[model samples]
Target: MLRSCLSKVISPCQSAFIPGHCITDNILIAYEINHSLKLKSCGQERSMSVKLDMSKAFDKEAERCGSISGFRIGSRGPTLSHLFFADDTLLFGKASLQEAQHIRTILDLYKAASGQEVNFDKSAVVFSKNTDPTVRRSITQLLNIMEVPTHDKYLGLPTVVGRSTSEVFSSVKERIWQKIHGWNEQRLSKAGKEIMIKAIVQAIPTYSMSCFKYPDSLLSDIQSMISNFWWGDGAKRKPIHWVSWDRMCLSTNDGGTGFRQLKAFNLALLAKQAWHIATQPSTFLHRVFKAKYFPTKDFFQDESTSRPSFTWRGLCAVRRYLLSGSKWRVGNGLHIKIWKDRWIPRPSIFKIVSPSDALPEDSTVDCLIDKDSGK
Candidate 1:
C-alpha cells in the first residue's frame, strides 16, 4: 500500500503535473496522521506542534551583516563581513554598536537552533592598533565578548603581522623535534628513517612555508634534524657523514635520495600562490590582494613599501621568479603597457625599451597598431 502511494507521488516527470509536490504533500499527510494516531494511543485529548527552524533566520542575519559596509582594506574596495572555516569564524567590521548588535542577534539565533551556547568567556574581540581603547571596550561590552590583545592561533598556524622570524617559528621546530624524538630510532633502519623524514618531517611546516618565507636559521635547524635522523645520529653523539647533505637533497636519478631542500620548496610553494593571483584573478583571495596591493597597476611592477605586511612581502619576494619566466601574448594589445610589460620575444630585453627610452609615459602596445588599415 505504501509503495503504491509512493509510486503515485514519485512518477516520471512527464507523468505527474508537478512531480515532487505530490511526494511532499503525501509525506506531510503521513506525518500528521502518524502524530494524531500516537496522541490518541496515549489517551491525549490535544497535541501541540513545536517547530524548531532557524536556518532561514541565520541566513537572513548573515545576509544583513554582509549587506552593511564593514572594514575596508583600502580607500576604495569591498568590505569584509566574516570568514568561516567549519566552526572557526572570524568577524571583521568597524568597531560600532550596530555591528556588535547584529553579531549578537546572529549568535542568539544559532544558539536557539543548535542547543549550543556561545561561551563569551572564551571568545574574544580584537581591534586594530589605531582603534581607541574606549571604543574597543564599548563594543566589547555591547557584544558581551572579552577584549583580547592578540590571537595566538587560527586554524593551527600562529597569527602574525610582520616578517615571521626564527623566533616566531620556534614552536613549529619544537613540535617536529618532539615527533622525531618520540620515534624508536634504534629499531628503524636507514631506509625507514628516510621514509619517515619524507612522509612526516617534510609535511610539518608545509602550511607555514606556503604563507611565509621561513628564516634561513629555522630552515637550517629543521634540515639538521632531518639529516641527523637520516644518518642514524643519537640524541647526544654525532654520526659519520658519508654523503653531503646537498647530494641527498638531489633527485634519485642524480645519485641522491630525493630529499627536498626546505628553502627551494618554500619558494616553489609561494610561487604557486603568485601564479594563482596572476591567472585566477576572479578568486576571492586574489580580488582582496588586487584591491589592496596593486589596485591601479600590474602585480609585477608593485613597488615594495616600507610598511608592507609580512604576507604581501612574501608574495612580492617570489613574484620576480614568476615574472622572469612569463611573457605577454598580444591579442588586442589593450591590456599590455608598452615599456612596463614584457610582450616581446627577446629573452634579455623582454620590454620593448627601458622606461627612460619609451616614447610616452603611459603608452600601451595598442599604440603600434593602425586602427583604419588591415595592417
Candidate 2:
C-alpha cells in the first residue's frame, strides 16, 4: 500500500538538497547574480540575504506565506525563497520590514514545529549597498541576527568574489605550503614522494579548481611549489632541477611521471560544471542559468559578451574544450546546422567542409540524411 500510494517527490529547484547537487551549486547561483550586476565594484545591492546556521533540525512542511516568498533573482530568474545546500540555508528578499517579519514568522513556525530554537548567534544577514539603515536595524532586531557585510565562506568555498582573483585565492597556496613543509621528506622514497604528491598535494585544489580557472601567475606559483616539494630534500643541500615542469605533467604513456598541470587540471575541473549544464537540462541549475544567460540558444552557442558572472566567465573560458572536442549525434539532422554546428564525425572541425556555393545560409543537415536508412 505504501508503494502504491508513493507519490513522486519533486524537490524544490532552488534548493540544493536534490541529488547530483552540491554546496558549490548554491555558491555559484549567489555569486553569479552579483557578478552580473557588477556588484564587486559597487559592493552593494538593494536586497538582503540571511544565512541561517540552523541546528540539527529535521525537515517539516509549513504553510506558505504569500506576502513575501523570498526574492526573485533577476527579472527573468526564479523566485528563490531559500537555498538548502546540505545543512546550510540562505534566505533572500528585499531589504524591507515586511520581508523580515515574514522571515521571523516562518522561523517561529519552524521553532514551534521542530521544537528547536535556531542559533541566531551563528546566523548572519548580508545586504547590498543603498539598503536603508533603518530597515536593516529593524530586520536584524526582529530576527535577532547580526548584520554582516558578506558571508565569506560556505562549505569551504568563497560565497563572495571580487576583482582581485589571486588575493582572494591566496589561501589555496597557503594550505598547500603548510602541507608540503610539515612533511618529513628525509625518510620518504621516490615512490613515497609520488604518493604524497598525488594523495595530498594534488587534491588540495580540487574544490576550488572545479569552480574557477586559476590565473596564469597563480598556476605558475603553485607549479613551482610542487616542483620544490618533489625535488627538495629534507635538509638544505640545494636540490637539482631534474626535468621541465611541462614534461613532468605528461601522462605515464608519454614517458613521464604524469604530474597534473595546474592550468589544464583547473580547466578540466571547470569542464565538469559545463558538462552538467550542457547535458542536464532538467536540473534547477540548468533552469536558472538558461533563463538568465541562454534563453534562446544552447550552452555551446552562448557568448560571454553579456554581463557575465565570475562563474559564467570561468565556464565560458573552459567552453573552448567542449567546442573542440564534441559533435552532435545527428540522429535527426533537422536541428543541426550544415555550415555552423559541429555534427560531422571528423577531427578538429566537427562540421563538414562542404562547398559553400551550393548551400544556403540557413541550410541544415536534414537534406543529406537518408529518410529510409535513417543514417
Candidate 3:
C-alpha cells in the first residue's frame, strides 16, 4: 500500500529515490510524515487522514496566492506565480504584507519537509522605483532577504534596463581580450588560428548577440582581434592583411574562408526567434511577449512604443528581414488580409495591391470568394 502511494506521489521520471537502491520504505514513510507536519505548520486546515504531496500542494497554494495578491502581466491564462530553472527560482507577487507572509510560510514549509534551506544571504528582493521603502523593509525583515537597489545578473546576461548595448556587453569584451592575451599567437599556425577564432573567440559574445543587435564598434573590435590572431600578429611582429574582412567572412565556395560576420549572424539569430514567435504560439515565452508587446495585433502590424526594452528593440529591428521573406498561404481566407497580407507567389510582388489602392480598411481574401459555395 505504501509502495502504491509512493508510486502515485512520485512519477517514473522523478524516481530519484528508487526502492532497494540504498533506500527503504521507512524513509519514504518518514518523508510523507514530514510533509504532513510541514503542511500543518503552514496553517493547512486538512486532517491527518489526508496524505500531503509537496509539488501539487505548492502549485495549488501558489496559484491561490497569486490570484488573490499578484501583479499579473496579461488578462489571459493562469497567473504566473513562480518560475523554476534547475536550482534557480523566481517568484512573482504583489508588494503587500499578506503576500509576503504567505511566501514566507510556503518557503518555511518547503525547508522543513525537504531538509533543504534557502540561503537568504545570497537571495535578494528587488522592488520597483515607486515601491515604498517602509513596505520593502518590512518584507525584507519578514523574509530575512536583502533588498537590492537594482537587478544585476539573471542567468548569465546582465539585466539591462536603460543601458546601451555596448555598456551591457563590456564584460564580454574584456573576457575576449583576456582570452586573446592568454593565447600564444606566434606558436599557432594559420589553420590552428582560424579554428580557435571560429570556435572560441567568435563564439564568445554569441549569447548576448542573440538577444541584442551589437554596435558596429563592438563588432569591429571583435573582427580586428580575430583578424590579428589569424595572421599570427604578436607583441614583436606585425601581421599583413591578405584579404578584406568582409570577403573572408563569405562562404568557401564564394572564394573566401567560411567565417561568420558578427552583425549578420546576430540578425539571423534574432530572426530565428521572430520566426518561432510566428510559428509557436502555445509556448510560455511567446504568450508572455504577445501579452506585453503585441496584444490585439500581429507581429508585423505592431508599432514600436516611445520606450521599449533593448531586447524588444532588437527583435523589432530584425523583424523586417523575417517579414520580407514570409508569404501567407491562404487556407480559410479569413485570417489573411486582401491587400496587406503577402499571399501571392511572385518575384517582385506578393500583395495584390498597395495599401492606398486597396479599398475598405478591413478587407480580406474572403471578399473574392463566394460565402455559400466552396469555391
Candidate 4:
C-alpha cells in the first residue's frame, strides 16, 4: 500500500500541470489539521510546530537526473526538456504525526492520480530545530530512519553538544593510518607531489593564507631571499657558507629559519582527510560513499594493500611523514621507481637528500637511486 501510494507517473513532456501541486496540497492539509488541533487544545495558544514542503520539486528533476532518469533532452545543454526543472519550495506547519501522515497519504493519492512516483529512497527528514537530542531521537522514531554517520572527523573538531575533545582526536587518530597504508608511489609525479603537498598544507588553518594578518610582504620577502641565495649569479657554481642563511631556513627549534616545510605540511593535511574517511562513516556524504564505493572492505584495512584504494594512494607523500630528518639517502641512480619493487638498474649508490627532495625526483614518480651508483 505504501509503495503504491508513493509511486506516481507523469508525462515527461507535460510542464503545464504544476510540478509539486499534490505534495503542496498534502502539506497544506497537514498544516491546517495541526493548526486546528492546536487551537482546540489551547483555546488561544500558538502552535510551535513547523512543517516545510518542497514546491516545484520536480521542475529540475529531469535536468538534475538527465538521461540517467530514462529520458534525455534532445538539446545540447540546459535547453533540454523534462519535468521538475526548478528549485522552489513551500514551508508550512504541522503539529502532529497524524497530520504529517495525512499529508503523506494525500501525496500518495496525488501520485496515483498522476501515474507518478515520489522516490522515497531519495528523500529524508532533517531536524533543524534547537540543539536537543530529543529532536534527533524523535525524528528517527517518527520517520523510521537510521542516522548515518557524517562528519566523523567533525565529531572531534568542536560541538555544542555531547562529544568530548578526546573522543574527536581519538577518532582522528584511528583513521589516520588507513590513509597512510593507502598511498601509492606508482602514479605520482613531481608536479603532483607539489600539488598534494600544497593541498595538505592548505587544510590546516594555521598554515593557510587565512592565517596571514598584514600584507603578504613577509612571505614574499622570504621567497625572494631564498631565490636569490640559491640561484643568484654569485651562487652559480660559487663557493658558499652553509651558516649564511641557516638561521633563516631551519626550524626555530633547530636554530634555522622558521619557514613552513611545504612537503611535511601537505602530508599532514592529507592525513586529516584519511582521518575523516576512517572515523566519520555516520556523516551522510561518507555514508553514501561507503555504500557506493567501499561497502565490504573495512575502511581501515587489517590486511596489507596489495593495491591501495585510489584515495589512499593519491596522497603518496605519506612515506615522507614516516621518515626521520629532512633528507633521505638515494641508494641508486634517479631511475628507481618507488612504487614498483624492481629497480630498472640496481645502483647501490648513496647521496644526501634534502627535505625539499622528499618528494620523488623531478622527472619521475618513482626514482630509485642505487646507493652504489651515486659515486
TM-scores for candidates 1 onward, in order: 0.77, 0.86, 0.79, 0.25
Name the best candidate (by lDDT).
2
lDDT of 3 at 92: 53
User: What would the per-residue lDDT of candidate 2 be over residues 1-375, giving only the tens digit for each residue?
Assistant: 453323235345334335666656766776655443234234344677788887643232321535455555546667665666556767766678877877788788778988888788889998777677888888899989998877867667777667788988999999988887777545577788889899989999888888887888888988888888788877656577689998888888997898998898899988988888878887667767877788767888854455566788889888888877788987778877888888878777777676486879768899888889876
lDDT of 4 by residue, 174-264 (tens): 3332332233323444344334333542233332221111123333433343333332333234334445444445776887545454334
Sort all candidates by TM-score, best to worst.
2, 3, 1, 4
Candidate 1 regions with alpha-carbon error over 4 angstroms = 1-60, 65-68, 162-164, 233-235, 304-306, 346-358, 372-375
Better of 1 and 2 by TM-score: 2
Instruction: Give the distance in Å from residue 293's predicted Cα in candidate 4 to where it truly belongs.
Output: 5.9
**By summed lDDT, which 10 consecutive residues of candidate 2 come out lowest?**
56-65
**Candidate 2: which pairs clash?**
44-129, 45-128, 45-129
Of candidate 1, the 10-residue stretch with the lowest lDDT total is 44-53
Which runs of model 4 end up more than 4 angstroms from their true locations?
Answer: 1-60, 63-249, 288-293, 302-310, 315-375
Return the lDDT, model 1, position 273.
65
Of 2 and 4, which scores higher on TM-score? Answer: 2
Candidate 3's TM-score reads 0.79
**What C-alpha lDDT values do all the predictions have?**
0.61, 0.74, 0.61, 0.33
